[model samples]
Target: MALLIPASFGNLAVSRRAHVSLTVSASANPRTFHRESVDWVKETASFFDQDKRPIMLFDGVCNLCNGGVKFVRDHDRNRRIRFEALQSEAGKRLLMRSGRAPDDISSVVLVEKDRSYTKSEAVLKIMEYIDLPFPQLAFFMQFVPLFARDSVYDNIANNRYAIFGWSESCEI
Candidate 1:
């Protein structure tokens, strides 16, 4: 499952030069995808805190996604969630292992010991781990039509870059 920030029209808290400013320069949002799913490859690995906890896979070049990561990190009081930038070795591998299309990198991918999900399914699952009002939204899972739910999620994913702005790929 996944989580969300209530949609709004305020100016984003992200930057436009992107992360590449830390390095050199490159522009153009690459649209071509090379494969169906990155998961076909051998599964990659991740770092754990002293105790074991799952991390999330995200687009590192996306300021909005990164900001979301920070928000999750800050709010997850149990420190139950960690992170994996979608561009990272582990992030890509997890995407594949979870049965998501590599080139389709749209949803917030979660890697538990077993499986993964996309769109509203994934978002709602992420909320489950966070507890409280987030987990409460899980109830919506039973009543909403999948197409109706996913269409909304799809619109948001497709427009995310335009709305949030992106940076060059980064290592953070």
Candidate 2:
């Protein structure tokens, strides 16, 4: 079961186990994942305490997703972000914290400063943390409406597998 909460751009479906105060933007269709009973707020707090850097979660087996992660790693001269595969334990926990199903890999998710950005918002926000020209480019792209940006994003994401291919196993 899920509780629907009104959000700025879309409705948020929060899971019963989600206790963290996370602002989710441009999320995908909601799905439920079974979670073991635990104190989620405390767990997330301790995890973030260990590392303050923002986390980027992606589809580990998708070639395009892996390429994007590599791009961020190479361009992020400051190394301000950490990465996790959406199928990994850490990624699953973060997804649950943000009220997303662990098995849902429809879009890349960025968790930073107690908020989550998904779909096109995650992509642009990621550019902001990377190298110089990308940030400038992202700033300019903000002029485009969210719906338009996400429409293109969804198109690419939906076809990523056929266009970019996928690996048999998760990597990086």
Candidate 3:
């Protein structure tokens, strides 16, 4: 059985097994779902640790996602972000604990102290920690309405495999 719960981000499909899957509608801006439910935050805290460095979760088999991880690692001179492929055990655990479906790896997830950011919001938050022009670009991009930004994001995500191809296993 599945229970439908209304959240600030979108409607959540909570399975009887307690798995939570985020379902975003075309009319809803993905950024609007920034606040993770308090219960979720509390549950994931032990696994993620409240004070550790931020973790970036990406699709391991996607060439584009892997490239993105490499770009962030290269640009992050301070090394503020640690990455894990969505298929990894740590990644799967975090996703389940945070109420997201482990198999839904279309979006890059930025897991911070008390919250997780997905889609365009995740990209922008990651950019804020990177060096030079990226932060500036992120700041500029902020003005583009969240829905509009996520629309572009969704288009790319939907075709990422077709455009970038996928490996049988995660490269990282």
Pairs of residues at least 3 apart in sequence or in different chains that clash in candidate 3: 9-33
Superior by TM-score: candidate 2 or candidate 3: 2
lDDT of 1 by residue, 70-171 (tens): 777766899887787765545644665666533335777777664566777777777787857777777767369889889998898888889987777753
Per-residue lDDT tens digits for candidate 2, residues 11-122, read 3332322222233432333232122233333446665887888899998888999999999999998998999877766776677666776557788999875688999999
Candidate 3 similarity to native, TM-score: 0.73
By summed lDDT, the worst window of 10 consecutive residues in model 3 runs over 1-10
What total of clashing residue pairs does each candidate reach? 11, 0, 1
Off by over 4 Å in 1: 1-52, 170-172
Model 1, position 85, has a per-residue lDDT of 73
The CA lDDT of each predicted structure is: 0.60, 0.74, 0.74
**What TM-score would each prediction reach against the true structure?**
0.67, 0.76, 0.73
Model 2 compared with the native: what TM-score? 0.76
lDDT (10s digit) by residue, model 3, range 58-141: 988888999999999999999989898776656755665446865568789998766778999999999999999999999999
Whole-model lDDT for model 1 versus the true structure?
A: 0.60
